[model samples]
Target: MPPDPADDREAGTVFLPKFDDRGLLTAIAVDAKNSEILMVAFMNEDALAATRASGAAHFWSRSRQSLWKKGETSGNILRVREILVDCDQDALILRCDPAGPACHTGARSCFYRRLEGEALVRVKT
Candidate 1:
């Protein structure tokens, strides 16, 4: 028999993340100070474990098929402040303090472009 979902939600104890069929969970990182969404990434079991153990943001790259620590190369590391699991436990919110630009393009956020009247407008930083 399957276990009750409430078992995973017991206060101050359990942390049962619900990974998808591909064994990855959608993780959204946001700025701890202003609540600006930084980026969206996927986390495998290993990546999730690493993040919890190290307090750093780690993700599984679908294209690279490997684990990656955020900002490992660009010095834009995300220091995780809190991790909130969705009600369904299928996704996670990572509140973090970013050291530098969150986007690879040197933008503050990956969501810097917005759709406006059939055009993609770049929001000024």
Candidate 2:
């Protein structure tokens, strides 16, 4: 039998992830040591399972319509140290040690720009 939601959802030990309508959940990768936000992505069941099994970060590419392991081509893998699920189990934080740049543009973080007055300014690294 399944665990009761009232008892096992927020305060229980059981892990029950609440996926969205697209069978995906929001996942944020952060530097485990410095707490720097690296990137944000989505993960499906297969991506989550792969991440758990491989100790590497994997994500479902919405545009590509496929599951991809980070650093498959760039060798900038996000080595996951810990996975933290939100209280609602709808979002996840992947505490990771990144091998290289997290952004596709070779920025240390995907959020390498800041919104200014009608412009996107590059953040000083």
lDDT of 1 by residue, 1-125 (tens): 99776766643366777788999999999999999999999999999999999999999999999999999999999999999888767799999999999999999999999999999999986
Once fitted onto the true fold, the runs of candidate 1 whose alpha carbons sit more than 4 angstroms away are: 1-3, 6-13
Where does candidate 1 have its weakest 10-residue lDDT segment? 5-14
Q: Where does candidate 2 clash, by residue pair?
A: none
RMSD for all candidates, in order, please. 2.2, 2.0
Q: How far is candidate 1 from the true structure (C-alpha RMSD, Å)?
A: 2.2
In candidate 2, stretches whose alpha carbon ends up further than 4 angstroms from where it belongs are 1-6
- The per-residue C-alpha lDDT of model 1 at residue 93 equals 94
TM-score of each: 0.90, 0.95
